[model samples]
Target: MSIKALITHIQELVSAQSGLAGLNLGLVNYGVPTKLPAIYIDGLTFLDDKLNSHTFNLCYVTTDLSIEQLDYAKLILAALQGSPCVQAQQLLPRPEPENKRNRWIIPCVFFPRALKA
Candidate 1:
């Protein structure tokens, strides 16, 4: 399948969650949302194992960084991990700048050969 299809699948899964009902999701190189709990594709790479690694950023844009931001990111991570369509890899926490926003970089791999094009 194409990257767009993967993005669509992830959007659908995240949308299905009541807690993330208002979360804004977007594609990378397009336009990322300025709102909190916003998720967007960050990068994509082809693996030698016939899999594609898709990197996504789940971010909370806030002037006041708190534990709530981390918690929300965790929730998103859970939803992403629960997806049966792709193999969720890892959720890497970004180092906070103390004055910058909080974000989690998640990398998920999917076998393109197994998915219908």
Candidate 2:
């Protein structure tokens, strides 16, 4: 599947959760929301794996609540890790300088190669 499909899936999941119902996941170029608990795809790239597929990382930006952010990250991880096309992932505590937006990164590699058409 494509990166947009994965992002759409995560967006759906985040929307379903009442606690995270308003979270928005978008490409990094999309205007950042003036809200908390948002996610953005950092970028996409081809992977060097045997599958020769694609890899990307999603940045989960939230408020400074460590526990709440952890919960949100866990929810995101669970949603992403459950995808069959997702081969692997590593979620790390990623901090940033923009408005104290606590961040977590979920770097993922997926199959169904993104070779040149």
Candidate 3:
């Protein structure tokens, strides 16, 4: 899938979420957001020369400091974390923000798809 398609897929995945259904989600140019619980797909990239692979980050922003956000973050992680298709990294809390912040970021990789050589 293309990058745009990947973004759309991510959006769709989150959009279908029952809890996060109406949350503010979109791409980011790296700026201060004006909303809470802002989930953004950013840092466009692919992990392979074939350009069939994709990797990006999800930043979950909210003032609600707790593990509750993890429920939302795992939605993406679980789907891609399966087997052979995609690889998902751990969703960790930001190092700063007093070790208890409002944002958690997960770096996920849609590993390179094997194509006939």
State candidate 3's TM-score.
0.61
Q: What would you estimate as the lDDT of candidate 2?
A: 0.64
Please give the range of 10 consecutive residues that has the lowest summed lDDT in model 1. 22-31
Evaluate all candidate structures by whole-model CA lDDT and list the values in order. Answer: 0.58, 0.64, 0.58
Question: lDDT by residue for model 2 over 22-44, one digit each (tens)?
Answer: 44544332235556656776667
The sequence of per-residue lDDT tens digits that candidate 1 reaches over residues 45-107 is 554343344443433333336766666666667777777656666667775677476667766
| lDDT assessment of candidate 3 | 0.58
**Cα lDDT for residue 47, candidate 1:** 46
Could you tell me how far off, in angstroms, the CA of residue 109 lies in candidate 3 after the best superposition?
Answer: 1.8
- The deviation in Å at residue 55 for candidate 2 is 0.8
Which residue pairs overlap in candidate 1's backbone? none
- Model 2, which residues run further than 4 Å from truth? 13-19, 22-35, 47-50, 113-117
Candidates 1 and 3 compared: the better one by TM-score is 1
lDDT of model 1, residue 82: 77
The 10 consecutive residues of candidate 2 with the worst lDDT sum are 22-31
TM-score ranking from best to worst?
1, 2, 3
